[model samples]
Target: MNRETLVEIKNLSVDFSTAKGALHVLRDVSLSIPRNRVVGLVGESGSGKSTLALALLGLLPDNTGEVSGRIELDGENLLDVPPEELRRLRGGRIAMIFQDPMTSLNPVFSIGTQLVDAQRNRHPQLGRRELLKRADEMLKRVGISNPEARLAAYPHQLSGGMRQRVMIAMALLCEPDILIADEPTTALDVTIEAQIVRLLDDLRADFSGSIVLVSHSLGLISELCDEVAVMYAGKVVESAPTKILFGNPRHPYTLALLACEIDPEDEPGEALVTIKGGLPDLIDVPKGCIFAARCPSRFGKCVEEPPLCEVEAGHKSACWLA
Candidate 1:
C-alpha cells in the first residue's frame, strides 16, 4: 500500500448465502483512494456499489453475507480487525451517509438527540450540551438554516433535502478520515443535489480527507471525482482518471454508457444509442464476461472471462477489445 493511500481494497469479494446457494455480490474488487481525493464508483442499480461500500465499513448483514480479502484504512487491515475495533473505527475514523436520510434517522427522536448521540459515540467524554452545540454547528456547516430550530424538529418534520443535510451534518460531526457517501443526493432535486455536491466538495477541501462517492450518474462523477471506476455485473470493467475516462472511454461497456447520453452536439434527427439486454443476475453470473451478452463488440474471445488489462497509462479495462 502507498503511504499516502487512505483506503486500499485489495481483491475484495462479498457473498451472500441464500436458500438456493451462494450469490456473489462483489468479485475481486480492488480500489485505492488516496488521501483527500474523491473516488467515484459508478454503476447501474444492483451492480454492488452499495454492497461494496457496506463491506468496506464492515457493516454487511450477519451470517447471510461474507466479506473476504483486505480492506486497509490508514495502513491497518479493517477486515482482520476485531468487531470491537471495527465498531470504534466506524464513526470515529470512517463515516457513512446513506441514500435515504429519513429511514437512516430515527423518527421517534428529535434531530438534535440523534446528532448528540452520534457525537457522543465518537467522543464519549463530551457532555450533552457540548455535543448539542457541535451538532448545531455541523448543521449550519451543511447549509441548513436555522439549525437550532431544525434540531428540535423530528425527521418527519424536515423536507427531504433538509433531512439529507442533517444526515451529512451527522456524518461530519466526527470529522472522519474517510467518508463513504452512498447516493447522498439521490432524494434531492437537481438544485439541492448540486448544493449537496458543492457542500461535499467544500468539506473535502476544508477537512483534507478522502471521499468515496457511490452513484450511477456519470455526469455527477465527471464533475466531482478525480478518479472513476465503472462496475458491471458485480465487477469493475474500467478504472481510469475522470477526464481520460470521459474523454476516450475504451471498454465497450464504457463506450455504450457514453453513447447513451444525449449530447447537445448531436443532430436533431440522430438516434440515441442504448445498450440492449438487462444486467445479468447475480445469483447465476455467467462464466465468461458478464457484459458479453450486452456488449456490441463481443467476439469469440469474449466467451472467456478477460482479466483487467492496462489499455493505457493509468487506464485499465476488463474486455478483450480493450
Candidate 2:
C-alpha cells in the first residue's frame, strides 16, 4: 500500500456458485484507489465490473462460493475484518451507490427514512432529528430542490433522475472514504446522464475521498475518471491514466473499445465499428489470453497468457503486443 492509496485490491479472484458450477467472475484482479481520485472501471457487460465493485465493500451475494486475495483498506486487509467491523466500515469508510435506485431503495420507506437509516451504522448516537437534518443537507448538496419536501417523498413518487440523486445523497450521508458508484447513470436519459456526470465531477471539490466509478460508457469514464482500468472477461486487460489511455490506448481490446465508440462526426449511413466476438465463458476460461479470439492484433504470441506488465510509466496492459 502507498501513502496516497485509500484502497487496494491485489490478486483478487471470486467464484459464484451457479447451477452450472462455480463461475470465476474475477481473476487475479488488482487495482489501486488513490485518495481523492476517481478511478473508472470500464468494459462490456459480464466483464465482472459489478462483481469487483461488490467485492470492495464485501457485499458479494450469499451464493458467492469463494473469494481469494487481499482487499486492503489503508493497508489493512478487508477480507480479514470481522463481520461486525466490516458492517461498521461498509457505510462509514466505504459506501456504494448501486445501479438501480428503484431496486436499491426500499419501496416502503420514504426518502428521508432511507437516508437517515443509511447513516445509522456510522452515526448510531445521532438522534432521528439530527440524522434527518444531515440527510436534508446532503440532499441539498446533491441538487435536490425543496429538500425537506423530497425527504417525505417515497421512491416511487420521485422521478428517475430525482431518485438517482437521492441515492447519491444517501451514499454521501455517511461521509465515506471510498464511494463505489456502479453505473450510476445507467437508468437515466442522455441529458440526465450528462447532468449526473457533471454532478459527480463537481463533487470532487466537496469530496476529498476516492471514488470508484464502474461503468461501460467510455465517454463518461473519460469525463470523470482520473484513471481508467479496462476489464475484459473478468481480468483487467489494461490500466492507465485517463488522458493517456484515451489518447493512446495500447491493448488491442482497449483499441477496439475506443474504435467502437459512437462518434458524432460520423456521416449518415456510416457503419459502426464493432468487436467480432462475444465474451468467453467464465466457467471454462481460456488458458491463454482471454481476448485473443476478439483481438485483431493477436498472433502466435497470444497462445500463452500474458502478464499485466507495464508498457510505460503509469500504464499497464495485459497483451503480448503491449
Best by lDDT: 2
Q: What does candidate 2's lDDT look like per residue over 1-322, in tens digits?
A: 3438888899999999999988999999998889988999999888999999988988889999888999999999998998888888987999998878898999999998999999998899999999999999888888888999999989999999999999988888888999999999988877887788888988888897899999877887898999999999899999999999998898998888888776745421121236787899899888899999888788998989999999998899999888
Query: Could you say which candidate leads in TM-score?
Result: 2
TM-score, candidate 1, is: 0.91
Q: How far off is residue 195 in model 2, in Å? A: 1.4
Quote model 2's TM-score: 0.94
Model 2 lDDT at residue 304: 99
Collision count for each candidate, in order: 0, 0
lDDT by residue for model 1 over 1-322, one digit each (tens)? 3427788888898898888787898998888888878889987777889888988888887644767789888778888889998888887888899989977899999999999988776899989999999999999888999989999999999988889889888888977888889988877877788888888878876876788999867777888898899888789999998999999888888887777654634421122224677788787878899899888788998789999878998789998888
Clashing pairs in 1: none
Model 1 misplacement above 4 A? 1-3, 63-66, 263-273
Measured against the true structure, the TM-scores of the candidates, in listed sequence, are 0.91, 0.94
